[model samples]
Target: MSDTTSTTADRKLTEGTALPTQPCSVVWSDGRAFVLEPPVWVGLDHRGRLARLTPAALQRQGWSHDKLS
Candidate 1:
């Protein structure tokens, strides 16, 4: 049982450390939706408008942690 628990814990840690490489979806506070593609981090709005935001812009908008798989 102890070995099983250790294995489970290790598996959880490995899974938690992995970052997603695919495009993630995010929704702003004003009901606007966007899809953030990685590598370039370009945002595509709900209306199909493309907007490229820098890290500072993203931080200012407070969308640094709302990525959905």
Candidate 2:
């Protein structure tokens, strides 16, 4: 028989540790989705939060406030 009890230290995942690369999928805009594969760097921003960047965010710094012709 093997020991089943595990501690927090044993379950912890090291930050920035290199693991087997795999393609990861994400959904956005209700049904729109995409996949990011290996060799792509994945890290958190200064704010330390993960969020999907919307189409409006790609145009300019503040497309929402910018006047459209």
Candidate 3:
């Protein structure tokens, strides 16, 4: 038996490492809605809305953002 890990490029997108080009709708904690573009990271709350986020900001808020697939 051989033990090997397969590396696939397609999995990168689902891994939340890639940025999207199109605009995405996001909702803030106060029920405010907004749109964000690429290079900006965002996360969804329990209501399934895009919330503004950044690597540094998220770390402070203890929240994790996922890329739109």
lDDT of each: 0.43, 0.28, 0.37
Candidate with better TM-score, 2 vs 3:
3
CA-RMSD of model 1: 12.8
Q: Write the per-residue lDDT of candidate 1 for residues 1-69, one digit (tens) a residue.
A: 353453344344434232334577453311334445664346565466877765344434434233222
Clashes of 3: 0
> What is the C-alpha local distance difference test score of candidate 1?
0.43
lDDT of 2: 0.28
Query: Tens-digit lDDT track for model 3 on 1-69?
Result: 111111122233234443334668342222222335555645565477556665344333322132222
The best candidate by lDDT is: 1
Q: Write the per-residue lDDT of candidate 2 for residues 18-40, one digit (tens) a residue.
A: 33335563211111222234433
Off by over 4 Å in 2: 1-12, 15-18, 25-36, 48-69
lDDT of 1 at 67: 28
- Per-model TM-score, in order, reads 0.35, 0.21, 0.29
Sorted by lDDT (best first), the order is 1, 3, 2
